[model samples]
Target: MKNPKLITKPFAQNGQKNAIPENYSSSMESNQATWDQGFGPITMIPVAAGGLPPKGQDFNGIFNQISESVVYLSMGGRFKFSADYAAAINGYPKGAILQSDDEKKEYQSIIDNNKVNFNTATQAQINAAWKLFSTDDMLQQLAGKQPAGNYLKLGDYGIGGEFPPEVIDANNVKLGGIYAPAGAAGINFYDPYAPMFVMNRNGMYIRQFQITATGKIAARDIKGEWKVYSDDEELKTRFLGINSTAVSAKQLSTKSTIAGQEFYGKGETITITPQGIGAQPVGNYLKLGDYGIGSAFPPIVADADTLGVCGFFAAAGAGSKNYFDSYTPVLVMNRDNNYRCSLQINVNGRVATRHRSGAWITYPTLDEFNAKKSLGEGQRWQDVKGSRSSGVSYTNTTGRTIALSVSTAGAIASSSIQIFVDNVLCSRNEVGGGEGTNFTRHCIGYAVIPTGSTYKVEASSIGLWAELR
Candidate 1:
């Protein structure tokens, strides 16, 4: 065998052979030269022995190079091409051990896997939340006279946007920014129709509106829910009351009687009264003053101590003279505040009333008017006949009424009923045809009485018995 190996020129280069033997040694040497030329020269010499690779140092060198510099990292700041990817390419102690079990991986391995979770979050939500950090505005605020620190955080004081008119639309119609328009008057410009709040230069509400002075309820509707704005002035608005649609009121229940109650779906409510004495009597009781259109009652200021008539309460000047003294009983109406008709009292026992002329016709209370009097023996003190020359008078009483009925025993020429109060002129009611049997009907019922006031009822001619009601 001398050399059948010698005969074969295994280390041949082209057609020539080197002085080296034609053996494995020669063959390997030739291959090594080809490998060095094709690739780069070996960078890491094997520093250890291991079963991991054909040559430990050779494998580590290649892997270390890929991790540090050789790998083509995109470097676009995108997920796949980021700096983190570059850190993960190496093997062993210098590279990432990517596995579901974190205990087997290093710091870079944990970071690399976390990238998937990062992409799962909503980008827009992240951008929006991050914008609220107000980094720039905070920095400027802290650097009022000096530069801000690198680590310290600053805030925008709740106001947002750039110093200039920031363009946020494609056509540039929406206009807004954080800029001072004129001499020290800073403004927050924005689209007028945008669902944003109007604020002052200090980033506070422009003006506060409240149902209560403390603004406890903030905003509410007559028939809907209320919105509270206690601590959140920056919250967007819904144009409360401005853009809201109207809804009709629905009646929930009704009982139209004295002391009866009525309820509406919109929370409106009312209750009838005995004589308008309790609970917002409104029309049930009499009011001393009123100023609505076609209002009848004028304010007569009575003494608070003794209820004595002090003076007439009227408006100032010109047409305000007769307005102080009420021409008729007044009812302060509030629903819609419309003038329905002439203010009149159609009570059961209406003893006194204002005749067409400015004269008061007084009468008696129901109790007093219903009592039968023998030749004015038991007649009421408030009784007043239309034909009476001097009307009846009573110093003090709770209430009184008046009743009048006339009949002729025989054919008479004429008969009339006249009445007056406090010497005020009143018209007389006369009967012309007093034939065989004549009869006329006149009755009075419940009438009210002021505690400390005097009452008077008079009659000129009473053919029949005038009795209490």
Candidate 2:
């Protein structure tokens, strides 16, 4: 812009060249007059209240939010994923939008072809996918597995995959991180099938005790197996030998057990071995009852169908309440089918076998009582040989005809069992699915018995017999 011509003083025409007179221009002296142009005072221009295109109102940015392949929206609220992402995630082809009825049919076909059975997903799988997503490819342990949706890589965040520990740390997960095998990796005794937890306690990472496949207690860089040896005569720990769990210096392969005459057709002896390493062998196989093989050694004993030493007195049952027929007894009944025996409550309040030949023999001494207690309750005891008195019974001593009021404990489903005492059927169909524990209390009424006769169980199961009050 060109400046307007400056106002001049008329005295300058005399050529006197006098100093410029003071107060020559009052308009220039004012501060506003210095910027005053020849044009009238500048007035403010009025503008309509138009603001910049709002950042939230960027139409181009909104359009770019979704991929280009996304078809137009219909009146319905459902938004279609772009064909590109859909194909990558769901194996759909390009332009497979449900615009027309034909397109809808194609969409249904895609859904039918790609649907998955959510019921098949396990809890571990479901938990892995809750908040899962792409960027976590490294953490998707199940990514390369056989995909149910026919995709090479299932979206990690989509389902059944975990975020890496790094991702978890970066995300500040509350009290969470990868639970990796911490002890020593390969040397840490890791069991993939088992639950493992690790913690850095005092700068030392620690975890559960890991047992080796060969049944050895091992640690990283630690030579040889360090077993838990007992110093006092108290603790008794059993160790699995190089080949067998129990080590027996002596083994007897006799056919028939002395007292019960349990059939050992396989010619394998029914040895009653000691449990734990020492704990004093509760020898006196006869003490186990009128049905066990005599063995010189403790621990490590097996017969044809018999495996453990505890099975000497009874037969082991299956998951279905020790399924067994009345015809077979697991143990034996002496040659004459009678044995000298008596029941007495021991210090532990247990009805233990006391006098069974020679001096009063006591089996499963105090320390080994744990293994013996399995017989006290809901254990499924069966009779393989199927003897007459297969359960625990007491002899009738007196000549007087006595009513043998025996109470039976241990719960039973009562579904297919015929419980009988002597030659008489005591009760039939008195058991059910919910009636199997001692807590359920299924008692048998008092029945008359011959005097001086031995009382014994007639069923193959863990049961209690007591003089009814």
Candidate 3:
């Protein structure tokens, strides 16, 4: 048989029995032992107190001393372990032992009640163990199920609980133009789509902003330049006015010499009359009347061959100055000889005459006789003659009714004068003789005959008389 030994003792201190007996022999082996039987070799585990020491101490005491040291080590170096040793035992790392029977039973109850598998235990199974052995709060910490103070909710990541700050700034701010807030300093940012910043105060809300590109800046300036007009020489010299400078002149003729007459060209002339000169020419100084010659002039006479002729007088009355007659030497003649001569008379005014010679005689008609009777009472019985050789004669048959007188001087005769009453010959006589006798008789009568009547005179030896009605 093997010798039995007492590995541990039982003693009393602080009113609790020691786990080992006082008189226990080292060689005793009994069914009731203070220490575990068939336990593994005694090993020294050096432990430090409170905080970990620089070097740990080993225990080589009696079994009880060793057991107490083990208890102290398992108690985490505390003088008094908690009455809730099950909770204490749970605090140990996995696979550590329970110190008391109650702690073992409590730990066994936790293990039995919990469905824990060391290889397959999850945080949920460990939480079940903690609930059986420890507090609800301690179980929560053990299972890593604690609340996080700064945990982000769904989709909450960056500042503003949204996208990045820099990205938001870039999207919202105007890129290029100067930013001049109501009363702040102007910010220098240049972009094409921004407005020019006009600095204003006093809360005048000009809320507009503008931007322009470099190319657009030049274009706008050029557009403004197009609207600009300048009187300056530098600008005017570049842009000149278009107008015409050439002019044309035309010639015209006028009837006026007055100063304000519109003159189109040089050297225009006008004519003037005597009235224009305000005077007339006098004293044979070429009147328009002096140019009257030929049929337009009055008659005149000159003396010829000693014939007693008066200067040409207007034909014996207040008649035209163009009339005249001539008289010559008187002569007596026998009743039956030839006589022939030429007689001359001048016509005046618009009057004229012609003569008949060979064998023609003239007699007065009743109207002539009556017209002659209406003339002043005169001596009757005048005998006129025609040229006898020319075979004609004339006489007055107005008996005792005094006949008109005749101028026998310068009359043609031998040249018998015969007077006829009605158709009958009443008297005959002769005047001038020998061959060159020409005679003309003047029969005087009233200038007018009765209204319904007419007068005529016929001369046998010479001149014609135009009767007036």
Candidate 4:
């Protein structure tokens, strides 16, 4: 009889009426074909209608195949299928593991008595019957094995989609970016913004925080003992200004006392140095108030170098005449600071003195003064000749005051002498000669002729005419 569940074909007995030698002989062969075709890797041999029981070789063949699969499982190797497969009688139990056709990944049976060929099944069917156990790619990655290009694929770590290639080694991990690695121990993290951070065995470096980058560092306070080395030209020049030839100014602390005087504000600063005789901000300029040299008191009018005054002091030295001279006004003032007088010398060598209450008075040189005095004495007496009928006119060309005089001789009682200055009659004298005997008459006009004025003297008799300037 056939087995109820796992059926086996008929096998020959010792004595059977229908058991011929050839049929008995071929029964085992027929059953072997059926068993081999049904179970152990398919043989494709068909079973006859009344075939003998399954052969012993077929049973052994199936047992050997199961043993080989068990050996693969015990050795940490997955049972790999060459093609889609399913069992006719027995099914893979739950937890049965096998490899895919390509052997890139392994799968396990998820349901009891699963008969689905997971490699060839639809995704839904495979999900119901099998589960992915592990992947060869992930195993290679975890073992520190890189791909053909020595670059690690992110997809191997379950990351999907395309990305820039990267490398991960035993010493360092380098994510792809614009900046290249500088050393074997260097590591980098990168993104689209090109922000990269580097770390090695020596120290950590953040690209954004470097001083060369254009950004500000924000903090409440910063304290450090590190020294910075820079090669910037501007910074070097500015720092060189603090050398030996320069003044090192010290900033004053707020509300601090300096030179026995309390000062305010932190912005206040001071620079101190040796008090040389001609140093600046101290001894370079003269101080105000009373000052004297050689003696405490000197005459108001004295020769040079004998007295000193409280005023601007310039050292004596031989220089050009124009060098020591000021083209502008030089004023002398009283204690009220009002200009009492001034002394100035003109370019023509004329010295002028001025008083606060008066205008400027100029004094010529000695030669010019002598020449003018001689000219004035010569102009004191000037002679004039004229006819008795007409008047003699004299224009006062000399820049001095003058008077006119007229004398007549041989004049009758009707003869007269008259003086007119600037067309105005000033004096008239009637000359009287006794009958025919002539007598002289003098007409002295007391009229003053100003500079640039004309004076005329007329007489009826011929006589002398003169002007007193």
- The number of the candidate with the highest lDDT is 4
1-469: candidate 1 lDDT, tens digit per residue: 3412222211122333222222233335322222234222332234253212233333444344433331223221111212244345331222233221112211222232233211112344323222222232455667686754643123232135333332232122222222222222322222222222222334322322123334344432222243555443322122222222333343455432221223334445433223223335336533444233234534532211211222222233333232223333333222332321122332353544332223444566655554423333444432222212234553323232333333222224554444333343243455565457565434221222233344344433443432232
Q: Per-residue lDDT tens digits of candidate 2, residues 245-310?
A: 332232235444332223344444344443334445666545533334453322322222232223
Q: What tens digits encode model 4's per-residue C-alpha lDDT throughout 187-283? A: 3221222222322232332121112233322211112122234455534333432222324344566575433335565675665343322323535
What TM-score quantifies how close candidate 2 is to the native fold?
Answer: 0.14
What is the C-alpha local distance difference test score of each model? 0.31, 0.32, 0.31, 0.47
lDDT of 2: 0.32
Worst 10 residues of 3 by lDDT: 218-227
Give the higher-lDDT candidate: 1 or 4: 4
Write down the worst ten-residue block by lDDT for model 4.
217-226
Better of 3 and 4 by lDDT: 4
lDDT of 3 by residue, 1-469 (tens): 8734433322221232324433435675332233343211221222342232221111122333555655555545422223233243454444333322223212222433222321122345545653334333665676587565665354332223333112111123323223322223223223323333322233342222333443222112211221222345443223223122222233345333222223444444432222222134555453343222223432332222222222221122442222223322111121223332223333321222222222223345554656455433543222222211122222322221333222122443333334333334444445445565354433222222233322223234433222111
TM-score of every candidate? 0.14, 0.14, 0.13, 0.24
Q: After superposition, how far is residue 282 of candidate 3 from its true place, in Å?
A: 99
User: Which stretches of candidate 2 lie above 4 Å from their native place?
Assistant: 1-394, 415-422, 426-429, 434-443, 452-455, 460-463
TM-score of 3: 0.13
**Which numbered prediction scores highest in TM-score against the true structure?**
4
Cα-lDDT of candidate 1: 0.31
